[model samples]
Target chain A: MKRSDYQTEYKTDLPVMVTPLPKTGGSFRFTLKPWHGFVILMACLVSSGIAYAVTDKENASIFEVLVRWMPLLLKGFIFNLVISTCAMAIGTAVGAALGLGQISLHGWVRKASWLITQFFRNSPWLVLLFFAMFLLPFEITIGGLTIPLPDWVKAIIGLSLPVMANVSEIVRGAVLSLPSGQWEAAESLAYTRRQTLWLVILPQCVKRMLPPWMNLYAILTMATVLASIVGVSEVMTLTGQALSAEGGQTYWHRFTPLFYYCFSFTATRFHGGRYIWKRNILLSTKHCLRGP
Target chain B: MTTNEEMPMVSIKDVHKSFGDLEVLKGVSMDINRGEVICIIGPSGSGKSTLIRCINALNDIQQGSILVEGQEVNDPNLDKLELRKKVGMVFQQYNLFPHKTALENIMMAPIRVLKQDKKEVEETARALIKKVRLEGKEDNYPGELSGGQQQRVAIARSLAMKPDVILFDEVTAALDPETVNEVLLTIKELAEEGMTCILVTHEMAFAREVADHIYFTDRGVIVEHGPPTTFFDEAKDPRTKEFLSQIL
Candidate 1:
């Protein structure tokens, strides 16, 4: 037996040989190595722990502060949850309409929709929140009916203004990014313009529309702090009050994905803001990746 | 069988189309008969593709009416989608949906457009896959296939809709040398089986072999049109002869 080489039945001076094999799919093939994966995982965890420990030594940890005031933290966390859910629902519905309107064939409709998105997106969210709370009527009468738009309405309007822009851009780009032929292809299949938008175009666009959706949600949580100036007893307002009482050197708004959910009434009640924020961030990431 | 023997299947009268200040088609007129394979050969920008697209209501004509199967294609009140259902189109790029699997792409138009039963569409889809000689590759995406295979899938997807007339907008211009024969042969077989096709093609040999009617266009006008035999063998237009000589 030869150790170096195999003896062939036929030898030829040719460029190639024919081989029948199954076709491979995709740009490149990947293989799983469990041992390598485990090593990488352990290394990542060890490095992250060392990094966090160093960060804690330099500053007083908010995690520890929230742990000390667990009861009040829980209260604030609930307020944070309410603002995000309400704001996101309002933003998505309004944004989808604006995005579709901007692309509408009608000249006036397209122009009107484009103007609204541009104005809201460029203006500061905090400024808009101030206007909604301060300038809007106390008891507006419409058709002999008296109703209050409420201070909470200001919070949602502020949060939704920017978030709607984000959602509108996402939806518009998703709709436009679809191939020009999808419209023609749908037409050839006997799908009406409205039916194509609902069935073919929107369904196809949703899969590509999810990742950016999370960023808009994260921004909505941060924007809720604007409610504090409006006398809304939301989480941020309560947290500011706690810091003012504690005689802390200074408190900067922590944008670590979540905050406390405090209920806003005439009297404010605090909850464990830390725990709720953590859950919100975790749930949001999962929802965004796994889809609605 | 389209029962419009007295009236032409597709009728275009005094058609004019423009872009900005430039006119692409200038007062063109033609009638496409029922169950006919017509080859439209011309110089670039002759508005051949646009003409067919207007027939399907994909492009709007500026100053004329286009009728498909004896119905007005350009009526503002007419359901453009329903009008398009009877007119299939094949592009130079073979615009198959990249996100869908091959079988799913072929099945979508039939199920969505015709509202056919899922089982029936699937059966027809399988038959189409077989007809295009793409067995064991139903699950593959269009992006995974070669240019030839993608074009074939585009062909099959249009076939699934069962359009009255299929418009070929230079479908084989994007294929490679060896693969061109495979696609042209498939088209030849279609012509033999009585598919009413309007082929906008660069391959003169395929046009000579399969076209019942041939129209040689030059700068948005039909310079000459007749039976394939006279049109190719003894072309009266000097521009067509000059064009054919450069390619051949």
Candidate 2:
């Protein structure tokens, strides 16, 4: 008999478990297992309702104010996301290169990676961003001709600088965690050292490295709102404009807290991760929902 | 190297290798014709493993020389990939890719390094797995197989490369006593089929049973070498007799 048929024949005495478990005290096992999920959802709705009721004094429906303000808020959120994603992409690339460069046998390459990483990590991000936006535009020159980058470009570079430092460290940690034997094994197969690192070691490190990297992405997304200080019109900036509007502004300005909360939450997309990825580590932000 | 008359497939001449100040292999040399099974028995850190590893340029040595089937080992001239293609190695740890299945592990070297035909490599890989009596375990990952089975898969993986010399680096030392038999049997079966092999092992009985000749290595030097019967029966070196007695 074939392997499958052999298994089936030998498994004749094994029990089949097709039918779902019977209801337990008026709820099924699957539903019972989702208690934490249900509780979180109920908690979210309750807090959102309470915040909407107490924080905003508008006599109109919360929905009406939201609808009027939605376009500008959405544009701001999309703007923030674009900036963060682009900056983080550059950060990751630079970081991986720096990490690899730092591990080089050459003293100069190691020193170069060290200095670059240190310069970004020790200094303040906001100061760098502000300086780049203001000073860089006037001071720098190429070929005896002075030219300036645009505001948004400077802002992205400045914001991305700090992120690159952290990414390099993370990449370095992942690379170092691999056993030395793994490298030797590849070498034993007569692969060159560089080929061994690229083919065998790096892919394994990536799988183990992704969780921390995703968490960093969340933190980076939150930090990118600082870009609005330079008139980049990120979510918080749009909120300020809506609240203190001269023209093309809505009544949703009075309900800034609600709109900001919803905007941040939705843009960050903090939902449905349990079934899809199954490796969530963040605790619930209940106070975030309940706060002004 | 073999043809009942040709140059030895591998020849090492006063080969000396060191790591920094720690000299490991000091003036060690050996030669083997094609299709001969030569087993190198040694105490720990005796450089038997390092000698075999050096044959394919796995580790570079500072002095003397090694030649594989006419190509100088440290030859700035030889293509490394081509040199490695002719000499396959099996590690004590099996070193099978944990993420890939047994069949996939066997197929990877052939497909990736040799660039062999996909369908042909698949068929050859299947045949190799069967040769090692791991027919039902092809789709299983290395982690899922027992140590003996994994080592056999590793051996089959080397066989898939169609190498002239297969270096076995203490291939059965990591296995359990019961499992050691299966692995030794698999290797013994290979030697009987006229595969050229260099086994670095402590299983003196298996080494005696399978090896055409035996060499006892100590402190990075080949102390004695002879036909297996003479080496085991009348080991002249005091160190060799002591080494054999302890392991036996």
For each model in turn, which proportion of the native inter-chain contacts is also found?
0.48, 0.25
- Model 1: CAPRI class: acceptable
lDDT of 2 by residue, A56-133 (tens): 454455456556777888877777777878888988999888977777779999899988988887878888778768
- Spell out the clash pairs found in candidate 2: none
Query: What are the RMSDs of all candidates, in order?
Result: 10.0, 8.9
lDDT for model 1, please.
0.74
For candidate 1, write residues B1-248 as lDDT tens digits: 35568888888888888877878788888888878999999988888888888888777878887888878866788777777778888888887765678998899877876889999999999999889888988988776788888888888998888888899889999998778887787788888888889999988888988999998888888889988889877887888888878876
* Model 1 native-contact share: 0.48
Model 1, which residues run further than 4 Å from truth? A1-66, A135-150, A251-292
Give the worst 10-residue stretch by lDDT in candidate 1 chain A. A261-270
